[model samples]
Target: MLFVDFTPPAPCVGDLNNDGVINTADLAQFLGQFGQTVAPGTGADLTGDGVVNTADLALFLGRFGQSC
Candidate 1:
């Protein structure tokens, strides 16, 4: 017999609201650390344009909290 343990991993993004998924909420958390250089990740890829920058931040904020 083989035994397997199943457990969900911790969220890589911080979306405290837990609205079925993480996106801008997580980005909002990142923005708090803006103007300070830091490593990049999914939340930083706001516009999905293959880079992180002010434009992505603006796009994220512009459409925050609106379900698709």
Candidate 2:
């Protein structure tokens, strides 16, 4: 017998709410924290650059309509 894991990976970083989809809600969330660093609970830093800026915006735009 063979064992394997078939579970899909977690949603993209853009899915800020972990809602399994990257949509307006996530966008709103992203915008809400667009100028701050990685705070206690905010997660809008899509590029892991320690700050939310164009880099993270670009990455978020890339996955704006993604489903995961």
Query: Against the true structure, what is each candidate's TM-score?
Result: 0.38, 0.81
Please estimate how well model 2 matches the true structure, expressed as its whole-model Cα lDDT.
0.83
lDDT of 2 by residue, 3-66 (tens): 8989888546789998888899989998998888885434998777678888888988998888
Listed per candidate, the RMSD to the true structure in angstroms reads 6.6, 2.7
Off by over 4 Å in 2: 6-11, 39-42
**What tens-digit string does per-residue lDDT give for candidate 1 at 1-68?**
99887777654333434564446666666576555444444545544455566876676566555543
Model 1 bad stretches (over 4 Å) = 1-27, 33-41, 49-51
| TM-score computed on alpha carbons, candidate 2 | 0.81
Candidate 2 C-alpha error for residue 52, in Å: 0.5
> What is the clash tally of candidate 2?
0
Q: Whole-model lDDT, candidate 1?
A: 0.55
